[model samples]
Target: MKAIYHILNLCSFDVTNKCLIAEVWCPVNDLAALRGALEQGSRKSGANIPSFVNRIPSNGTPPTLLRTNKFTSGFQNIVDAYGVGSYREVNPAPYTVVTFPFLFAVMFGDLGHGVIMVLFALWMVLCEKDPKVKRNRNEVWRLFFEGRYMILMMGLFSIYTGLIYNECFSKPLNIFSSGWSVRAMFTELQWTNETLSTNSLLTLDPNVTGVFNGPYPFGIDPIWNMASNRLTFLNSYKMKMSVILGVLHMTFGVVLGVFNHLHFRQKFNLYLVFLPELLFLLCLFGYLGFMILYKWLAFSVRDSRTAPSVLVHFINMFLMKGSGEPALYPGQMVVQVLLLMIALLSVPVLLLGNPIYLYWLHHGARNQGTYRGYERVQRGSVEDLSVTLSQDMEEGFALGDVLLHQAIHTIEYCLGCISNSASYLRLWALSLAHAQLSEVLWDMVMRLGFRGDTGVGAVLLALVFSLFAVLTVSILLLMEGLSAFLHALRLHWVEFQNKFYSGTGIKFIPFSFSLLQSGLDQDVLIGEV
Candidate 1:
């Protein structure tokens, strides 16, 4: 029936001969299987079947067929949501598999929340096998079932990040906290302050004399959670971490372009386009990133004269113009000069190289046509073919037009590189919001729940516990989960994918029995079943 439908679409009637003629396009590799099927059908029908197969010359773009299995299907769906890749272009799905979940985890980290997500994903996976569930009327349930594996992986990655953050439901674990306590050391020092607050008790540095033997080896020392300046400490740490991760993620995206250019065999593009883009990014934002790290590591709290905020130093670099004067450091003047020169040089190379290259290419092809005469042109020489094919594909490229397009592209990339790097900071922003919201919920409701034991007090405590749980699930799990999901998606589509993906391919639609069956009357199938 599938074959018959395809034939019907292209069938031509031969009235005198009482026959039909048809044409069909099939993959070269599938020709043998198609022939075998035709022969079997002819034998079963007891009719003489005649057919001829010829190789078709490549004339246009072919449909893109993405090969994927159970493990990769979810990631492929994410890729398709942006746009399917062009024929023979590199598929971004494979790269997205690890990146999507990792980014989501960065924003959604919390062991308790991750555990909840994992349980939900597991339930969806289990429910997928049930026929009743497969036919579920709820769209939300259907979506969950479809992306169960993705959710599971995301939950697992969140758990890993959560562990690194030492956060479980906005509370730090006390597993190693007991051994690092400074209460014994304070007593030894004859510091008889009896009413030391939890914050004071926890913030004690182990490095101080006669304190604990060593610091906590794992995640953030749990003590940081209870410190007087906990919020300030976390804010500083998270903001700087965001910048670092942003730089690294964008750098990875730029590096991936190398593989894409190599795959497409466009070495000129690799050198002229991506290399300059990479250099500009590194020299500008990359240098600032190094300063950020240096500030964190070497900036002294006691010596205010030597340490200045990175943000101020960056501004001063641009605002303070002088006769080769070093405003921020002893030798920053030379580094800045070299970086500025390279950045300026790269701009013209990106804007002019492709147009120049194309001009020579087209000029050489025309000369070849003149020398070879009309006979060579009629025979379709390789040079003519190359020029004609490129012209057709690009709708007749001209030098001026190419130059303008290249200029626009270079400008977009240069600006986008700056904007996209800042965009990844959402990872830190959302994570901070989640943590703060969690803390608020705990203080508002859970604290009340823990306070009382008597009849009326117990009843009030129960109500508080109920309210806390409800708020946690609704606000933190459902609301924040969706928010983090969107941010993660934006990072992939705008920042990561823009680096390499062309996403202009037509998706492959194969002729299959299942497609034919689906098109059949549903009522008939129901009656038969």
Candidate 2:
């Protein structure tokens, strides 16, 4: 139909009957407008004219068209980058509006950097609104403007994460510093009480007491800033946080499959595929995660050795024949075994359930004489069922093919669950890199610049500051930002969206006056106008 419309010049008019006919496509929403325009045209022409619009059935796929506003346009672009959703399919852009920035901020969290981002986004938005700038703006600037809202959200989320991390410009805040004094507490070691830095005194340890009792209330304690084993502390915290967040994010994706299943009316798929997938994730990773958090909370750092390491325990559980010495606590071993068994059993159900059900459907259809071998079904009430039968036949519904496809899907999901979970460690890795890099910059450039006040020293300071600023912009803002963006994109596209999104839709390109004019102009040129 689209092809015929595209080559409409080839359509002939029946001059002998004094009638002209042509097909036109318009949006379903604008059917009334189209009818009104035809009526207006008939009246203007002062002749009795008639037109008819017929609803044509489509066997082929319909184009995807997303309705979006300024806020959602950036998210729509991100969704498009993965793949457009098919017509009437679930659109991922609305979800991406929140998830994409939240994920990005998880990796890019830093109070100072987030603030800088917010300011930059604000500037871009302001520039976009300025008449002079808007008039002269290049594509690059326009692109930035288009994504200003996304940037603002990203920056806002970064600030939230940064607050949770208790870091600003790679430095911990000292708001709670007055609660403790290091030298005073350590006076028994014959240390000078007056000289120790305020940060060095504060402690995250709940056992410690001075002006205040227990650990510093929020986000890493100020003492970690000056802790001898800061990297170890930060790495442990960041890695654990990443794992927890990853599990939650992926589980959320799995939960979304329920909606997709319901929307597509695939009840068998919902029960067979989504339920098993969710159960597998929860049983293995989710139970393991719970054990990890329990270990962290229940056991003191010094007594950590008393508990089995989650990672080592997982490996040993699978590899070791019998648990000679129990790695899990009390009845946890039994629970672990049960969960493992359930997870294993789910694989076959996930693999075979759908194919078998589909085969049964086809078999029943054949029995009903509704479907005939190698025969094309006519369009009518049974059109959908006929189409399905035809497609199944065309694809060759051999048992071997079904088994192979199901096996592949099962393997992919099994492997993907592991890989996708691990992929989230990039959040920890990137955060560590950003923090370390920020520290290095401060130590190498800013530290030196703060050393002196003389003429030569001032000159040296200015030069080093300039160099540091350039490096900061290049490495932190551009390079790291781009890297985080790509990783976040991957997390959403492959890990998150893969669970629910089909991403098989064609983009909608509606017929318009401009297109019509262009076609007419091309026809004229073809006629040597």
Candidate 3:
């Protein structure tokens, strides 16, 4: 009764690694019924519809939704993971567009270019579902149609960013400047003459000193009053900006790392091990500031005791400890001196730094300890993984290694950010380039003296000029756009995935045929009429 009951409840069967072929143990009398039930069950439930490569068996009792077949022997590392929850049947259309788009836009916001991208995304989404759009069928259409929700979300994000950036079309600042109705609504910050700097022509006049400053048109020169004079050290000095952005970006990554490490509590490690690298950034900068402050005070011959905020200064100098550890062993000092120096340096690092780091680290670590420990055991222990060797596994990677993997990931993300952000500089560069290229083309046409009522020679010349301009613009867009997309993808693949993924786990598969044919199967037996 127990054996029959187990067989009856079986939803699916999957072959494991090619070496482990499923034997299908059963009484001779039931074999036909079982095979028939399996086939029917598979068809009814759409089991194995989108099958994954099979490997080892899954961890739990197979759900009724999907199944896998076992194999006798084959490739190493092949595995399957399946989603069996009925809740997945809920429609993905409504939320998908909003979710992914918003997330992406929050990350990659820019106003003027977003409108075009959104329109393009929308057109692709709409045309993808239309079989009539293309003369020949395209497999790529499936990606667009199926991913419509994500694309839609992306578009909405683009639109939102566009509003924030105050840009639209090829020349946003210029076009938006003239919209009298929208302009009237925002009373707090009016779009005055200053906003019209988009296409301002360069001028040599002493009065026109700013980057985009040009000849003024009489009364309302908005550019003159705008905050163009404010120095943006990073924006003006791109390498410096890269360093600042890199540090901030790294800090964000480290914060995520801390959470991950905490959530997967490993044994015998300091809370500091899991702390995000970023928490130290401000501390490091403060230490630098302290050095500068100390130097200035010393040079000025000001009494250290009487200096303004003497206590704060003392804290900055004596207690400063930001760059991970104190700068111990500048050269080989004697043991006592080394200890003394570390004690001296550590006042800031240990006293001020360690306490704060410990507090936050403890907060995150405590909750993560249990859950993370369970995962570590199930995943074959991080330490055991580090030294484990397998013929099929990647050459350099070991089982339990996390730090090296994370470091590579950090580099990848940093590079990706740098590359992706660098790509956007093209937006500013191309917009200006496009305007200049058009102006040059128009000037050539004007110089040709092709009157509205013209002869054949002049008409031919005008047509040739127009063709050249079109070809030139088309080439620029195609080549430049292609380069940007490739660079962007490189960043995405390297930077983002490195931090959070192993992408090496086996997926689950199950078998459902026997369950389907038998009227007594669990799904049919338990499901609603």
- Note the clash tally of each candidate: 1, 0, 50
Worst 10 residues of 3 by lDDT: 71-80
Which consecutive 10 residues in model 1 have the weakest lDDT in total? 374-383
Arranged by lDDT, best first = 2, 1, 3
Compose the digit string of candidate 3's lDDT tens values, residues 1-529: 5334544444344446222123332434556776777577667878555322223545432222223221101001111111121211212122222332443443334353455456766786567546676443577665344444444545566567545433333223443233122333333344456654653632222221232233232222222223343123113323323234334433343444443344444322223332222323334432333434444445332343333442243243434322332322233124323433443443333223433433333345445763221222224212222322231124533322344443444444434443543443433333334334433544554445454455876787778667654644354333433343343333323332233333333232234535434655333442311
Clash pairs for candidate 2: none
- lDDT (Cα, 0-100) at 296 in candidate 2: 81
Q: How far out, in Å, is residue 283 in model 1?
A: 1.3
Q: In angstroms, give how far residue 122 of model 1 lies from its true place.
A: 1.6
The best candidate in terms of lDDT = 2
Per-residue CA lDDT of model 2 for 1-529, tens digit only, reads: 4434445554457787665665444568988887887778778887665654567876655566677887898999998988877666667788888889988988888888899899999887777768876676688777777888999999999899888787787888876653445555565344453545543543334334342345566667777777778899789878877888888888988887676566555566777788888988888888767877887887774566576667777765566344544455676666777888998999989888877766766777677887544333222211012325567757645767666766777888788889988899999999899888888888887889878889988998998899988888888877888888899999999988887776777677665556556666666422111
